[model samples]
Target: MSEYQKPLPIIEFQAQKEFWDGCKKHQLLIQKCRDCGEINRRSVRMLCPNCLSGNLEFIQASGKGKIYSFSTIMAYPPQGFQDDVPYVVAIIDLEEGTRFRSNIVDCDIDALKCDMDVEVVWEDITDEYALPKFRPLKQGS
Candidate 1:
């Protein structure tokens, strides 16, 4: 593929490293607290946000979700994203009970609706990185 011109994630810590690695392998990983069984969607914290325990593990997510909310960007596109105007960005509520933010692709923007079913689709932007975007679930899928 052509070089990815968009701003990439800054992986400055071990958790970030692991999270990005999982993404490269097409896996969506989230942190699970060992102490309280709480799932932390963000991977930056070393301690469990729910129980304040320094025990956490990465778990693969189901990657099936519904659109909690969304917005269609029609103007003032960010740097490196000028060609991708009129795209939909959404907050997805995953089946595993965690929320994730990603762009919605491969569907009509006017057809988007709240709570619409979606599933993960990877864009291998680089050899070492892949972005997990969401798309409307196909019929009977």
Candidate 2:
């Protein structure tokens, strides 16, 4: 997101800061389950959902995933993004076995499909904020 699409000021807390920092570094860090070694998707919690264990750590992702599901958002986006309507907003299933909601950019939106290979792309919207987006990875061409 750019300043225009996201014209509204974003409220941030400690966790969000750390998360954006990771994206700036081009590393996808999500909470990992210490009990069964599962990746925590959605949002991080103090304990693992599978085991109720408070043992969790941040793990770097491979930055590779597949589109599990998505929707074409034809309506107006946040603010600066009004020009890019009819875009793909999708849930990516990372190879490490976690799903995250992210926008699919850098490709033709109409060509999007479920299970298409994708790679992470970080959009630094502001000095303190960055949004993680995904784009379909091209095969050997």
The prediction achieving the highest TM-score against the true structure is 1
Candidate 2 local Cα displacement, residue 11, angstroms: 7.3
Residue-wise C-alpha lDDT for candidate 2, range 1-141, written one tens digit per residue: 344345533435555556667876767888887788877775857677878887877888887999999998889677666787878889999988888888999998778899899998887776656677899998971
For each of the candidates, give the backbone clash count. Answer: 0, 4
Local accuracy of candidate 1 as per-residue lDDT tens digits, 1-141: 556788888976787788899999999999998889999866457788888998889999888999999999999988888999989989999999989999999998999999999999999998888999999999998
Worst 10 residues of 2 by lDDT: 1-10
Instruction: Report model 1's TM-score to 2 decimal places.
Output: 0.94
- Residue 121, model 1: lDDT of 95
TM-score of each: 0.94, 0.80
- Candidate 2 regions off by >4 Å? 1-16, 76-81
Where in model 1 is the C-alpha error above 4 Å? none
Please give the lDDT score for candidate 2. Answer: 0.79
